[model samples]
Target: MQFQTFSSPHTDRPNSVDKVMLQVILALLPGVLAMTWYFGPGVLINIVIATLSAVAFEALVLKLRKRPVMPTLHDLSAVVTAILFAIAVPPLLPWWLTVIGMAFAIIMVKQLYGGLGYNPFNPAMAAYVLLLISWPIPMTSWLPPAVLSTNPLDFMQIVSAIFTGSPPTGLEWDAITMATPLDGMRTNLDQGQMISEISQSPVWGDFGGLGWEWVGNWFLMGGLWLIYKRTITWHIPLAFFAGLTGLAMITFLFDPESYPFALFHVFSGGAILGAFFIATDPVTACTTRKGQLIYGVAIGMLVYIIRTWGGYPDAVAFAVLLLNMAAPTIDYYTRPQVFGHGDNHG
Candidate 1:
């Protein structure tokens, strides 16, 4: 009797890469919507430009690398990366800058590193850092919330600002630009002002900055949704927040005059986004449960350190990149032993 070779009864888990990436895209929607509502149509334009650029770059790279382009394109990894990159960018950044950043992210950072799973850093963060270093002024020029803008930009006005560094009617984004909460804190601290004094500003509210707190809460909700969907575990997000809070509390207690409150740190800048979406990037982050916790905690600590002491007012990108460098080491030590393997310790 001829016997045919049999595969294992269990096929690999049915969730494809596309499904995972698509879930992430959906998870980001609430945060994206919040950002657009508060920041104006510039964010929407940035998203469109970044997404198209990323897809185009991905296809070009795949073609040159002789990879099967259709499968990869359909997976939506490029789109997700683009969205992340776009959101991280300044709302008023020039169109060419957006295009250049997206190209760098997709080509040099993502595809050049052997694409998706093999990239050592978060592509979006890498590109963001590059842009920050290259164009410090433009990268930090955030407009005040729509409520505060003297002339809230329309779609074409936003397009004009992004392409020409001036709005359609010659109103520069600088006229409407206001410091982000983190930036405000950093500047105030440098000027020897106390946190309590800074909190009195219109930019700040009870928990954090007015618009920023709401945006962070929305992202937090989206993160919880991801957890509920079983798309990610709670360990990383919980650990990240705990780490940030612990550091912030220590510093705040040491001298509340200088340091902002823990809640402020947790709710401002990209902390929520980093905690949920970026740190939980499955391909680049630690894989084991314990490793993920350690990885997230490290990111949180780095974020706090960089924000408090480093040049940048926000450090999510730097923190995430630093932790990505440690992921392999984290996984190695935290990996569970095989079921039948005897303990190696003598």
Candidate 2:
């Protein structure tokens, strides 16, 4: 007969920060690969540069703060931020901009706020907003999808473009780049063009745009997988889509020529990604179940309002950051009362 032996305190747990972040990285794969297939190797290059720089910056910040750098870097939260910021930027973004974004994300938005769980806002989105505001031209210069592009650059050319701002000898900047689907739609609509006329453009697809809609689909699949795995609940994403499509439908029904359909709004921009990834951030998002819905709904409504009328083409980053500021208030009001206390007797 052997006596059972258990560790002190006798507790067992199955999840960790590293594990959750790793799962998120896995969930991001389908979308990342779709971007690569549609855009080119610059996507991967940006990820690499951002990830490496994020680790380096995090380590530097930790060392300056006299903390154990290896342990902090091992958790891989910085890597997640890096990857998110990478995908958010233009594929052909310069190397320095990539470095600056990662550094700002890790050093300013993350580590300086006591690292990881203590940050009040999503680090990646903050960094993206900074870059977008500071370098509007480079940030907005998105390459046309491979299908739309007449001359897609090879890997070496992409590297060269990132480092040197030089396209291949035969091609110039104007020839290789085109507006993203969302940006193009906004531009056309503002120029007195109707949705019907714009839909006939070469960029149009069944839902959003030729290659872009497929990428959004893959991201949706990945988000569903995260929900299935219990990494994230469905409340935020569901509320987000509901709020977005609800408004889009209302507007479209009121004036079909002025507003696009709801599904097109769902599939066109960063709506799905923001709903699933950015808005659901554990550190910055609302924790209470009811509060999460409110948070998500606010983000959704702001997204539609901003993209429709605001100067920016994509408003996901801005919306998430704004709601991040409001999450604490939402949580405070929605916090459940303690059982057997506060007049609710046991």
What lDDT does model 2 reach?
Answer: 0.90
Kindly provide the TM-score of model 2 when superposed on the true structure, using C-alpha atoms. Answer: 0.95
lDDT of 1 at 60: 96
Which prediction has the highest lDDT against the true structure?
Answer: 2
How many clashing residue pairs appear in each of the predictions shown? 0, 0
lDDT digits (tens) for residues 114-151 of candidate 2: 99899998999999999999999888888888888887
Per-candidate TM equals: 0.94, 0.95
Model 1 lDDT tens row, 39-103: 98788789999999999999999999999999889989889888888888879889999999998
TM-score of 1: 0.94
